[model samples]
Target: MSDSTAYTESAKILLLEDDLLLAMDMEDYLLDRGHEVVGPFGRLVDALDAIPRNELAGAVVDLNLHGELSFPVIEELQARSVPIIVCTGYAELPEVKTRLQGLPLLPKPWTAHKLSSLMEETFGATQEPRDAPPSKIRN
Candidate 1:
């Protein structure tokens, strides 16, 4: 599909996943859809550090990052009021269910179509890109 077909406007999405291959695939998909991807951070500390340094339109975060729970990342995104979609294989875990009660959960092995749809739903169709200065990580 063409990059502009799904949504007229693109967004900057933060990606936090531990699996290198999976992260690359997701980054490619987001890029193809005309969205810029922030860190596909495999480490919790790195992901946390990137948060404040970037202006994120939304986030797609895995629940686990190298055996560490990503609750802090989720909390930080929530605090910023940035939309998040938990793309996790551990959605059924008690801790995940309890902690991420209302957040959207996109189970692992997600389809591009589903991701696009959910992104549009969460962020809407016509987003005006933020006027803030470029993200430090990008430079």
Candidate 2:
């Protein structure tokens, strides 16, 4: 949890994308929202290495990094029980599809409001129309 009074709070955001401009934009946007954007990493390997260390409440991911699929990074975040938001220009593979369950997916060229709403839903900040039954994670 973060301090409510903090103007700019901290969250460990692991973003993997090769596009330098996009990476910087995401980092800045998340930071402005009072989050600690950890890596706007352009490489898959560096993003993978950093995922396990942060106290993350949420994540936003670009599905491909430097021509490599970022499924491994998603797996690591899932293992840590962090809620993740995915941004993809392409369709997800079988592995990512199966692992995602009913989580929301935001395609590329999204607005800030969409990202904010989805992330809020993940963080228990939004109330579902009907109460969702509490579920447990196996393994």
Backbone clash numbers for all candidates listed: 0, 1
- Which digits, one per residue and each the tens of the lDDT, describe model 1 over residues 1-139? 1122232345677898899999888877776666767877888888888887767788899988878889999999888888889988888889679888988888888887778777777766332334432332331
**Candidate 2: worst-modelled 10 consecutive residues by lDDT:** 130-139
**lDDT per model vs. reference:** 0.75, 0.64
Return the top candidate by TM-score. Answer: 1
C-alpha RMSD of each candidate structure in angstroms: 7.0, 9.7
In candidate 1, which residue ranges exceed 4 Å CA deviation?
1-8, 125-139
Our tally of clashes for model 2 stands at 1
Off by over 4 Å in 2: 1-9, 92-99, 124-139
